[model samples]
Target: MATPIPPPAVTVEEILAELDALDDPKMRAVNERHGNDIGVNLSQLRAIAKRLKTQLEFAQQLWATGDSQARLVAILISSPKKYTAEQLDTMLRETRVPKVHDWFINYILKKNPESESRRIPWMDDVDEFVASAGWALTSHAVAQRVENLKIAELLDAIEAEMKLAPDRLQWFMNECLASIGIHYPKYRARAIEIGERLEVLKDYPTPPNCTSPYAPIWIHEMVTRNEGASEVT
Candidate 1:
């Protein structure tokens, strides 16, 4: 009585084809029109490329984060290439039972001849597109969710460029911070404190009609200092 489930749509060959596009020099056309050739421009281009890679990788990463079936689907859908029917069935079954081997082999075998789905980076990889998108998305998403109209698209763009996984980025920053030869504990402690502060601030509801505490106060501290005020508002 129930409708036969539509086939799990993507095919393996399609995945393999999609994986081939990586590092395609043609992708450079996206930025070649910018016409800048300075060191700053080179750095900017490098950052742009890194974001594209991260967004692509994170599309796969999202799959790894969901429920097992969902995760497996994510992996198949976003991975650089497809798995063999045996491999895919194995992964699907493993989503529920890690060691089970029994499967619908004939159907799988028949389907395996052309299992690849069309590679759809523009469609499948939202993260890559997302990384390149301007800050309007952030202001819209943030304001809609939290209702802060103080949105600055330019500031959001800067923040997005600056964002990174702290632990990972800190691992790199640690080397430079270490070169100064300051006591490592103080360095680490300061890092940890900043991390803690950021988490608290981000998670705390941005209070209605309240500006960010970390934002610079409007009243000039120079005026307050002349008035001999401490902790000037």
Candidate 2:
């Protein structure tokens, strides 16, 4: 049998070089539309992430010294399972850009074992990004039907805090409410009631036929869809 040659190992320096080489003005414009002003596209970052594979340690090194796009690649390549809550907190603290903030929350924090543990504490944090992360995580957890998640507590938080929450956090809080309505039939009525009371994002412009973030509208659409699906089944 012919011998198979192994792929050469990728080093941090090689990865850095690749990132620097792939900078594109057109991609930068595209990224700008997504709140990433950094000059690298998703495809390039994905390619680097694919090449580096999962290297938590190396990913940390990359995260420590990169621009927005590089840090994004780092987030993609890192193993969230290996991150401690404290370490993740530090990363969250360091996030200055909206794109990185969203990526870290959705891609890393949401997948981590510590996510549930951190959600409440993060929601309590005064930092805008941390609070946003908490709400975003809660929304995802509720949608996935995470066991033991205190839906009552979430509802309480929304009732008491949603009006006063920072702009970004309020948005996710609305999402969490919609998730409750969509996934937990028992809580659906309450979720819609809360949404109607809060009236969040009611004036925010939305595309035609798109679900509005105004909690009542969002919950109603989701519930209607669930009913349609159930009837079909």
Candidate 3:
């Protein structure tokens, strides 16, 4: 096959136009219920980023627009390695929209070299959202088996804090707790005990065939799946 011509580069305005056109009122209402105001579908936003490719400057311009959809595209196109810790922190703080904040953490900070370095500090941060991000980073680290994570300490914190934490923070902390139980066989009992006693997310409704977010239930479900997969292997 002959080589295809790449699409010409589009400016931020063009990208913004594309994003605005993609906006859906129904989608916005749904996202609003989940703490995000942006109406653009994530898959479509990602498709736009695929066309833009990795454009650091373009990403900066999009992020500067303060439009959540634009910021999502900015995160998708930006070079994870190009950001400094301070810049990432500033970007994270500026990202008030829930989806934007999540994309920034997952697409940028998680892939950045400074990810681990930021995790503890962010977890200790006074800002609930920032601390939630920290717990998210820590959950990722725990799942990946990063060195010296002090699983016991994480469990202790979750045990002591999760039930009283703000909604977002509690969710992430519960995630970390579940991650530890899933990944560390030795701590599985303790993790489940803490989760059961705290009763965090116990009543959160789950759709049919979907696992519950209550840490013990989540831990058991994931662990069972892993065991079955291992047996298959």
How far is each candidate from the true structure, as Cα RMSD in Å?
20.3, 2.9, 1.7
In terms of TM-score, the best-performing candidate is: 3
Candidate 3 lands at a TM-score of 0.94
Candidate 3, residues 5-50, lDDT tens digits: the string is: 6645888899889888989999999889988988988889889988
Query: What ranking emerges by lDDT with the best candidate at the front?
Result: 3, 2, 1
lDDT of 2 by residue, 96-127 (tens): 78889989998899889887888889988989
Q: Estimate each model's TM-score.
A: 0.18, 0.85, 0.94
**Candidate 3 — which residues are off by over 4 angstroms?**
1-7
User: Considering only N, C-alpha and C atoms within 3 Å, which residue pairs clash in candidate 2?
Assistant: none
**Candidate 3 collision pairs:** none
Most lDDT-accurate candidate: 3
* Candidate 3 lDDT trough over 10 residues, lowest sum: 3-12
True lDDT of residue 101, candidate 2: 92
lDDT of 1 at 195: 34
Give the per-residue Cα lDDT of candidate 1 at 35. 27
